[model samples]
Every structure is written in C-alpha cells, then in structure tokens.
Target: MMNGNALHTLKALDPAGGSQVHASPTDRERLLANVLNTSRPAPGPAAGLLRRWRWPLAGVAVATSLAVAVSTYTLFGPNAQPAQAMTPPPLRYAPGSESPRAVLERLAVVALKDTSRVPAGSSLYLKHQGWALSTRIGQIQVTSAIVPSERETWKKADGSMRWKQRTLPPRFQNAHDEEVWSDAGAVGEDPQFTEDATGPVNANDPLNRPAPEEPRAMGKWLLASQEYAGTAEAFDSVAAHNLDELWNGRQRAAMLRFLATRTDVTYRGKVTDRAGRAGQAVSVDSAYGGLPTKYTLILDESNGKVLAYEEELTTTAGALNVKVPSVISYFCFLTARVD
Candidate 1:
C-alpha cells in the first residue's frame, strides 16, 4: 500500500481534485511514472520559491494543462554514469588570500576593462549546461533523479527572450537509482518542457531592466528584487541567485561592486568548475526554499564572467531525500555572446 501521505500528495496532482486517481491500480502506475517526467515553466525572478512548492513537481500535473502535464517525459538513455564520474569534482572551499570585499572590488575593476559591448539592438545569447534534482516521495522511499541538461537563451533588453533546454543522459548515485529510472521507462529522447518562445518579460524582475552600470544603482536594483527580508545578507543572496539574468560584463561588474559593500559575502578560494574552467569562488549562506543552503558562484578568473552557480544543503535536508551537504542544483555556463 502507498503511504497514506504519499497517496495524499499524489492526490493533489489531480486536476479535478479527485482521489480516485491514486486508488486505481492503473492510475497509480501512471502517477508513479509521471513523477519523473513532468516539466514546468522556466524559472522567472526569484519568487517565493519556498512558498511556491508545497509538493514535489517532477512529473506532476498542473491545473492548467492536465493532459499535457501527466503525459510529459524526461527521457534518458541507458548507460548513464554517476554524476561525479560525468563531471568535474566539486570545488573545495578555503579562505582565499584576498578578503571577499577586496576580491569583489578587484573583479569589478577587471570586469570593467572588458571592451565588449552589446549593440543597441543586439540580443544577448547565453548557453549553459547544468543539472537539477527531480525528486519523488513515497511512504518509505525518497528518490532524487539528477537530470543533466543544456540551455540556450537569447535575451533582449526589452525583456523578451527565447530559449530551449534539452536533458542529457540522467545520472545516479547508486544502482538502486538506476533501477528506478529503468523502471520509469527512460527510453525517450525528448525532455519535458523543452520549448522556445519569446516573451513579454517579467517586468517585475529587478534585474530584468536596463542593467545600470553604476554600482550604487545596481545595489538598489538587487535589493528591489529581494523576496527575502531586507538586509545586507539578503542582498548577497539576491546577487548570488540572479546572475543568469544579468546580460553584460559592465552590469555584472556593477553587481560585484555592490557586493563589495556588504561585509557578509565570503570569498572562497579558487576552483575549477564542472566545465573545467578556472574560477574564483564566493559563497553566501541562505535559507532559500526554507532549506539551509549554501549558494556559491564561481566567476571566470580573468574575465570575471559567472562560470557556474550551485546550491548545496549544509545542515538539514528538509523534505529533500538527498543527504546533507548534497548539491541540489548546479549549472555551468558555457558561452555568453551578443548577437
């Protein structure tokens, strides 16, 4: 018998709010598979993520698209490898010789030296390879499926953008996980929610604007975007989470300059990101998504562009099935260009 709690949560996925879905044997099987393959919209501004997800949504149905949500899939081929074997080792954190403030200030200087400028009407194209954990909860079992994928986006100053993301082969920590994926029928090529569309940008996003080059203005912009309490540390969290939304070198430099003002950000030592690019790492601890997580960003050593960002659980797993100190989500940026 499914745990009453799991059954209850699965019941929440029903578009009609029907309990019969979990009671029927055929429906149960379908729901089990749906947990792995459902897809949602790409992330917008750092909305109340903790408040947003009361339940796991890996392959679950939403109220708006009942048929499509239930039928979606995150395909993975056989012969998936362990995530560690597939990617570079996690960057170790040590106290860098330079203080976080000094490093940020220095990076701001180097970043500004870059002469590359976006044309008045050109779009910013960015491509990154990364993975996020897809979780499923049962009465006695909590499973996380690591889905590695690539994303490419063309973003415009007008807040219009289009992107396509495709999942690569899924990875696991152990054989039991492979069993779960194999049982989930991972034989397809299309990953769910992989689509392309231009947009009326989320105008409310603080970073989704004319990215100011002035450090003080940039600081205010970052603060305006914070969904958390208004504090210096919260400002750090906002800067850490919104790097993907920044379009150009100067804007990022302004961001680093703003971070330099806050005394809370820590300058972690150098690291080779998952993509094998050398970067300087800095981190801030945040209670994001209601979980104790350490968010780290690795910036290209020379150019100061963001190379990767990762979120790892530090103390508690909360409702996550993953172990403490586990990386829940990570992304390695491959290319950013103006076109």
Candidate 2:
C-alpha cells in the first residue's frame, strides 16, 4: 500500500488534471487503514521523504495561489480602473512649419470676422519715435539723434483731410554732437497744426480711391501708388509704413491677403519691439537700393495690430568707408483713441 499522505497529495494536485486518486470514500478509508496497520516504514526513510518533498510542495502551493489571485483580479478586483487614452500636447510655434505668408493669411481670416467699423469723423493719431544717423561737421565718426514726432489726420470721404504734426528736439550723443545739431537746426521742436478748410470735394488724390477689398486689386493699387516699386521689399515697406493711415477692417484683411501672395516676405521668428512689446517678427529685404536694407514689421498676434515698423541699414550699407548695422528709422504706433 502506498503512503496515505502521498495519496491525499496526489488527489489535491490532480483534482482537474486527470483521474482521481481515491474514487470513493470507502477506497480512501481502506487505503488509510492499510498504511496505518501494515508496513511501518523505517523512521529514517520517512524523514528523508518528508524533507525531499516539503519545499517542492510549498512552492507548488504558492504558485497555485498566485495564478488564482491574478485571474480574480483580471475579472473583478477592487479599485481596478479602466485605462484612459492619452492626449497629445499642443503644438509650439515653429518657423519652418509655416511661411510668413501663411501666417498673415491665417490672421486675415480672423480679421475679416470683425464687423467693427471706424466711426465717422474719427481721427487717426500715430506717435512716431526713432533715431536718425547723422555725421557731425569736422568729425569723421557718425552719431545718432532721437527724433520724436507725431501725426494726426482726419480723412474725409472726399479726399479732403485735416492733418497736424508735433515735432521734438533731436537728442544727441555728446556735447560736440549736440553743438553741431544745434548749429544745423535740422528739426525744430514745434507743434504744427493744419486742417482742410476746403470742404468735401472729389480730388485726384490716391486716398480718394475706393477701398480695395480683394488681394489682387489691393496689390495692384499698392504697386501703382509706389514711385519705385522695384522689389517686394519696397512694396512691403510701403504697406507697413502706411498701414495705419491706409486701411480699416476689411481693407486691412485685403492687404494682409495680398502680402500672403508675395514670396519675398519671410518669417523672422519672434521679437520684442523697440517699445518692449512682444510680437511676431517679419521682414522683407531689397537690394534695389545701392546697399542692402531690411524693412521689418512687428505685428501683435492677439489683435492683428501693427506694433512697430523699422528700417535697418544692413551691414552692406557703406558710408565714409564704414560698414555697420544701423537703424535708419522706426515708427511705433503707441495708441489709437476713438474721437
């Protein structure tokens, strides 16, 4: 007769794998009696058998428990939650992703949605500040002077308009430069005021033309209005310089869309304007001049506002045998209050 303990162990392990070790209660009792009453094995042999099987039996029990626990968890475990789909992060601004033309096109779409109009009799006031490069008499070195100026204009439908300008004294670098500037009296600190006393009458002024609301028409008008529209940069400069004075809501959209059709407009990343305002930088370069020059415009992304317009004398510009980067002029539109 086999050991009764071994039979019970076999029954437990083979419960589902194969036939049962004890088919009935009577068979199990008979086997147990045979093991207890018949041959008592040597004590040393029994001890050796228990030692050999103890660790293996414990390992099997642990493995079975683990399998059962994993299946239970997969089916119905507490605190188990379904997996969630991951979301991607937002896209960052990359210059290579879109051209400046594309960027302006997108902004134009947003601008055209605004149905707000400039009220009748509204005045367009622009504050301009920049430095002008000047060489002092009897001096070889060049210096710059700050020039602060402003313009106010109320354009009427009939090309007649009222215009005013306030000029300020130019700031010089040193006493010698200041003396030269004073002696020359290049610009005076005077408040100039003027108005169109002539009432509404159609004149042949370019401002009198109907506003262009399409890209091709706007481009044609811009090019025809320029005295030297030889390059895209020159045209772009004209657009930037006259942006505030030229267009309103839908007209501005047309101008922007026109810019998109130009291939020379380049995206110049982002920068802070001279006024320390953050904006997207764009520029057009023209070698049409004797020297290379860059006309840069910074536009506020939030409101489609032109923050600043700059003209930089590139390193290619040589004067007095000196080639250096200099700002020829800049105009920053500080504020516009409705009248």
TM values, all candidates: 0.65, 0.55
Clash pairs (backbone) in predicted model 1 = 38-59
Best candidate, TM-score: 1
Candidate 1: C-alpha lDDT: 0.58
Model 1 spans > 4 angstroms off? 1-89, 134-144, 173-180, 187-193, 202-207, 229-246
The lDDT for every candidate, in the order shown, is 0.58, 0.49
lDDT of 2 at 264: 80
Q: What lDDT tens digits, residue by residue, belong to model 2 across residues 1-339?
A: 568689787887864677645468998888888888974321121122212222222112322332343334324533221111011111122354568887787777777876677665555543343322221111111222344445455545553445444444555546865555344343232332222223664557553455577887777766653445444433443433352354555776787777777778888767777667887766778654345667676767765566766655565544312234545445566664443
lDDT of 1 by residue, 1-339 (tens): 568689887877878675444468887788889986875554321112211221213222222221121223122322332222112235676557899888888888889888777777666776777654432111101122455667677778675777776656666657876676466544222454465666676767554556678888876765554444333334344433343354467877987887777666788888887788888888878664456667777877677778887767678765443356777567777876775
In model 1, how large is the Cα lDDT of residue 147? Answer: 55
lDDT of 1 at 52: 28
Each candidate: RMSD to true structure?
A: 12.5, 39.4
